[model samples]
Target: MRPHTLALLLLLLATPAATRLASAACAGEKFPAGRAYAACEDLPKLGASLHWTYDAAKSSLSVAFVAAPAAAGGWVAWGLNPTGEGMAGAQALVALAGSGSGSAAPTVRTYNITGYVPLGNVSTPLDFPATDLAADAAAGGRIRVYGTLQLREGMRAVNQVWQVGASSTAGAPDKHAFQPDNLGAKSKLVLAGKSPAAASPSPAPAPHASGGGAASSKSPNAAAAAAGVAAPVALVLALVGFLATV
Candidate 1:
């Protein structure tokens, strides 16, 4: 076998493993009613994901946050913390599932996390302004919360917090679990319109919720995206093997 041919065959065999490792959680995620974003990340914790677009000139950010509740009839949430890296100062958007009949759409609300207690259905205005707050249920019992936020001029990054609760009381989010995954849910979010590589393993301060013990823990969308990658990889390997023999 020619050296060049062997190299080609090796490359082909290596392709699928490379593709799968590079696959991100949101690579093929679908939004309700065909919503889209320029960038996204499979957040490292809480089985949550974030899709977003940032307009630097206008200092505006639009985001779609996806996650499932801890149980049926539960709630999920996402928020940005301007003042610190934890939940105390976070400007949050919480989503509640619809009525048992499934007639109502999931509801989205904003909460100003002043401390570590249950919000009790209070819809507090965000410290930093947000608009178009909304939520909808998705396949696999996940819920998505969408919103646009106005940020200070030239802001480049901020702390982010997300959570899931087993239930809600009177439309407010109950406390999330205290497991390691839950506690690890908060991280620094780079406000860039780029790939997921820039978002993971946050370089900012280690996350710690000030008001309550904040933490959270993954998404199912990655499997769908990875499946799409397999077809092309198989074709490449087959073609390479045929060429090597010839």
Candidate 2:
């Protein structure tokens, strides 16, 4: 066989196993010492994950939101939407790396998003009560936002929105990308019952400048299907690299 042909065959044979390993790594995620939760789920978008425990009696929720920013000095946010399912009307906790100063640690802040504007500038109160908000860097360059929220009475499930941005400005979260994964980042989070509940997609308001203000909803399957396409494209790129070398 030609050198490039042999390389292409090897890459094709390895792609499935590599994909499986990547999926398994997310599935078997482990928390740092002293950070434990009742359940966790690998979210379908943005390569994010959530570990949470809900207290039914106290109507409290403890959550650790985990995701990597799009680049260094970027930010990540995870939030709950009490009034709606999309980014608008959601209570978000944003994490940004701290500047290099004395005792300059990572920080997490709360943002009550009223619209699809830039999140860094909007620092308002959420609809519900939240406390113990903190952020820190984790292994693999991922940022973790840890907080406990006091939900309304009888809120068994919640609409969740998560995002990762390319950069932040002056300790504020910048706007995240509008890629398919970013747009499809919102989902339904079940607080109780069996673990790893199937995610239900929510209808987000049409993003600003995407024409006019309307409802733009994404199917859960569409995100999953788009995620699957990435692996094949990556394999093809690797094949092309091998061919160039040959």
TM-score of each: 0.75, 0.67
lDDT by residue (tens digit), candidate 2, 79-149 = 99978889999998888876665135567888888997765654678777777677788777788887778
The lDDT leader among the candidates is 1
CA RMSD per model (angstroms):
9.9, 12.7
Residue runs of model 2 more than 4 Å from their true location after superposition: 1-27, 101-104, 198-246
Q: Residue-wise lDDT of candidate 1 within 102-171, one digit each (tens)?
A: 7678888899989987797768888778876778888888998988788889888889999998888888
Instruction: Name model 1 segments beyond 4 Å from true.
Output: 1-22, 193-195, 198-246
What range of 10 consecutive residues in model 1 has the weakest lDDT sum?
A: 210-219
Q: Can you list the residue pairs that collide in candidate 2? A: none
